[model samples]
Target: MAAVRIRIDLAYDGTDFHGWATQPGLRTVQGELQAALATALRLPETWVTVAGRTDTGVHARGQVIHLDVEDEVVIESAGRAKEPPLATLVRRLNGMLPADLRIHRAIEAPAGFDARFSAIWRRYAYRVADQPALVDPLRRHEVLPWQRPLDLSRMNAAATDLLGLHDFGSFCKARDGATTIREVQQLVWERDEAGVAVARVIADAFCHGMVRSLVGCLLEIGDGRKEVAWAEQILAEARRTSSVHAAAARGLTLEEVGYPPDEALAQRAEQTRGRRVLAE
Candidate 1:
């Protein structure tokens, strides 16, 4: 029997979990999903790998994971091909797991689909509270509250200098094997209907604390505390600089992941990742 591949779409409030990886005696997305899979398949704890490893207090709306199952599991489900009979799995998992985690969808993934490596681009949204009033109670978990009025024009101008490829050491947490280089495809700051300030960044990849630090510097520029050239100046340093500030993690959300629309997209993404590896 051949190995079967399964893809799962999931979302969770990360306030309670330590992170995505499984650690003994700690609740994690991978840990919970592996437990559920083991129970459903009557196998030992195994066969689940995620596309992203989100940090504590970070939330995801469309996270993906891949699992390999025994052939029997796949064969038995082949008759009902339109939709996998994963509703039962979702229900069972929900019943056993804590309320914060949820299995949004479960189905068979395309052949050779690698959850992490196959991803083309990752997008993140960061929210800042610029109003003098306290943050709304409802958004406290997801938005960072900053009382200072920010200059949007200034923030955008500084962020523009960071649009292309650059060594972003100033924005990253120091770590071994962590290269501070990344390509920021898009960056924008805007006000939502509720008038909350939102910073959206899309990139092929991000280093640890990169987004938060970027937000911090941009906010400073917005508030006129720092010059518009500050972001660029620090970025040119090509190493961690004390001048950059890191925003609160709670305000960041993994908004979405970009994939190739067709086979061509997949090819292009692979090429891009390959080049990234070479550059590193």
Candidate 2:
């Protein structure tokens, strides 16, 4: 049977999810999403590939994924004859998914789109309310309440030293056989409209715990606990250190993922999948 690749754009509050991946006995975004897709399409099972895998309590505003299904299954199970299969699938999946998760759109994927590797960059934002009074009750789950006041200038100065391609071992949880080298396209700290300190980080990809750890280290500098030079020193160390702890997961949100033009999609995917190494 012929298969059609479907692309799904979604957003979710990750507070109640274990993470993006399916884990045994854990309620996860992947587990919930896959189950709903199967039920909606009347399929035995289906698997999806995500643009990036977020950690527990890390939210996403622009997550993307792709899955292949038999063409006949989509058409026959759509329920409404007039509506397109992809549109019906979106409505059905959202109806069954929990309130925290929502599918924004579902459509046929462009040729050569891999969801994961076809992307050029992933952007994330971390929010911290340094002053107790600045913490909004409604956004408490998404923002970190910091005990000490933060110096945004100091944080941005410290952040400047960590950008560009480098081995980010100090900021990442060591993973077997996975290189810690990554190209950071952007990293900066600034205050948002509500006076909350926000760190915007964009990179080709991130290793486990990189963003949170970077935030934690920078926070130390922001609060005057660590010197401005400390960030560069840690990066030079090229391995995780005892001084750096990953910031609370709740503060982080994956805000966007960027992909190349259609003609470059396959090439970009192939390049991203290649093994990366940084020169000494």
Candidate 3:
């Protein structure tokens, strides 16, 4: 049987896991999922490619991954159950997976699909509750509780200065030979009915710690600690600074990832790979 690739939609609380990549002795989303897949499919081992690698305490609602396996293996894994092979796989995986992680859907991937390289953009949301009344005790794992009152208007104004293409070295954790240049399509803040300030960020790609660091910078502006122009100045410097530490990871969540149509997937993947190599 031909090897087939499957696209998977998943979500995780991310409160206890040690980020997405596997470590030698530490827990990770990738390690856990790979193990579960191997056991379910009766394979010696399994590996997966993820759309994004999140940090500790960060959550995800629309995360994506791709896995490859023999077509007959997937079919037989269902064990004559009255469901599609992929559906049975999903059910089996959920039963084996921990409560913090969930496999939402799985299906045969369209031709030329590469979960990470084919992605056009990724969207993330950061939730912060500044006032005492707005803080929800039940959601402490997901929302950030702040002492100072935040001004959404100020945060939005500061976020606007960060829009468009630029070298975002100031907001990223140093990575050897990695390019920090990215195009931010949107960086805006708004208050929900519950009065939580949510930062919506969309970008072509993000460097390590980019989203949380961006939110940290905006948080100071919202609380009147830093002037609105501060964000722009640091961005222009294009170097990391001690003043702008990353926000708590709990507040951040990967909400969505965008991809071009099936026909363009292969082209997009090639283009993205070339750009990164050139930039590096």
**What are the lDDT figures for the candidates, one per model?**
0.78, 0.94, 0.93
| Pairs that collide, model 2 | none
TM-score of 1: 0.88
In what order do the candidates fall by lDDT, top score first? 2, 3, 1
What's model 1's overall lDDT? 0.78
Residue range 1-280, candidate 3, lDDT tens digits: 8999999999999999999999989999999999999999989999999999999889999999999999999988889899899999999999999999999999999999999999999999999999999889998998999999998898889888899888999999889888888899999998888889899999988999999999999999999999999999989988889989899999999999899999999999898886443134
The C-alpha stretches of model 2 lying farther than 4 A from their native spots are: none
lDDT of 1 at 242: 80
lDDT, candidate 2, residue 62?
Answer: 95
For candidate 1, the per-residue lDDT at 85 reads 58
Candidate closest to the true structure, highest lDDT: 2
Q: How far is candidate 3 from the true structure (C-alpha RMSD, Å)?
A: 1.7
Cα deviation at 159, candidate 2, in Å, is 0.7
lDDT (10s digit) by residue, model 1, range 1-280? 7877777888888877777888899988778878877876667667677776888788888788888887686456344545545665566667777778878877777754767767777889998888856479888889888878877878888889999888888888888876677889988899888888999999877888888889988988898888899888898887888877788778988888766654554565466455343245
Off by over 4 Å in 1: 74-83, 262-280
User: How well does candidate 3 match the true structure in TM-score terms?
Assistant: 0.97
